[model samples]
Target: MAMAAEEIEALITGGIPDARVEITDLAGDGDHYAARVVAESFRGMPRIKQHQAVYAALGGRMGGVLHALQLTTAVPE
Candidate 1:
């Protein structure tokens, strides 16, 4: 099943646990998604590391179930 916005938000929140997450469905198909995640957890990490953290949260579903995640990560102010 394609993931809903809330489901994606939940997964990101589950990973960072302290983030302010925003998920937008770029396509109505529920496959193209854009996410902006802000969290203290990302404070010192490099951009690649931050993205890696989020991807890890999806486990092995990166290609099978989830596709086209346009991710943006930020450190909380």
Candidate 2:
């Protein structure tokens, strides 16, 4: 099963209430996506950890219902 963009967004926001999330369907298919997430919580975190937070928000859906994701994360400027 493929994941919807809204579903992805909701999951992220659910995990990180203060996050600003933007999701794009890169392939016009629900299996592929790109997400840019900005949050105050990310400040002082390593880039790898930032990405991990987003993945954790998906609750292990990275390789199953959600196939490919090109993710970017940043703290609020």
Candidate 3:
């Protein structure tokens, strides 16, 4: 099953209430997406951990409902 962009955003926001999330359906298929997430929580975190935080928000949906995700994370500027 493919995931909806709203679902993805909700999941992220659910996990990180302070997050600013932007999700794009790269293929217009719902299965492939690109996300840019910015949060104060990521300020001191490493890149890998920042990415991990976003993945954790997905709750293991990647490679299953969500086939592909190009993710970017950043601290609020």
Candidate 4:
């Protein structure tokens, strides 16, 4: 089943309490998505690690229920 944007946001925010997450449906198909997550907890982490954190937040949904996530993560300045 395809994932909804609200579900994606809920997963991310659930994992990262302090995260500010924005999820977009790239194809409007509920399968393709883009997420921009900014969190204070991400400070001092590398870009790859930041992305990893977000992926981790998804709890292994990347290729399953949630597919094709173009993720961008950043720390609060």
Candidate 5:
């Protein structure tokens, strides 16, 4: 089954605990999502690393319950 936005957001925020995340559906399908996360944990991280960190929060659900995730991360300014 495809995941819901709330389900995905909950998993990400719950896992990170210190993130300000905004989740969006790009294609109106549960399979596609874009997330912007701002967190102190991302400080000094590279763009790729930042995205990876967010993916890590999903615990290997990237290909299944969480189909496609386009992520943008930044440290709080």
Candidate 6:
């Protein structure tokens, strides 16, 4: 099953309360997505850790129902 953009954003925001999340359907198939996430909590985190935080927010749905995601994360400046 493909995950919706709203679902993705909800999951991310649910975990990272102060996140500013923007989700895009890269392939228009609902399975592939691109996300840009900005949060104050990511300030001191490494890029890998930042990506991991977003992935963790999805609650283990990344490779299963969610499929592909090209994710970018940054701290609010």
lDDT of 1 by residue, 1-77 (tens): 78888988888788779989999899889998999989898888999999999998767667778877999999977
Residue 28 miss distance in model 3 (angstroms): 0.7
What would you estimate as the lDDT of candidate 6?
0.95
Residue-by-residue lDDT tens digits, candidate 4, 7-69: 999999999999999988999899999999999999989999888888898999999998799
Off by over 4 Å in 6: none
Total clashing pairs for each candidate: 0, 0, 0, 0, 0, 0
Runs in model 3 with CA error above 4 Å? none
Task: Compose the digit string of candidate 2's lDDT tens values, residues 1-77.
Answer: 89999999999999989999999999998899999999999999999998999999999999999999999999998
Residue 6 CA displacement from its true place in model 5, Å: 0.8
Best first by lDDT, ranked:
6, 2, 3, 4, 5, 1
> How does each model score on TM-score?
0.92, 0.97, 0.97, 0.95, 0.89, 0.97
For candidate 1, give the lDDT.
0.87
The stretch of ten residues in a row with the least summed lDDT in candidate 6 is 68-77
Between prediction 1 and prediction 4, the one with superior lDDT is 4
Can you give the lDDT of residue 21 in candidate 5? 89
lDDT of 5: 0.87
Instruction: Write down the lDDT that model 2 would get.
Output: 0.95
CA lDDT, every prediction?
Answer: 0.87, 0.95, 0.93, 0.92, 0.87, 0.95
- Top candidate on lDDT is 6
Q: Candidate 4 clashing pairs? A: none
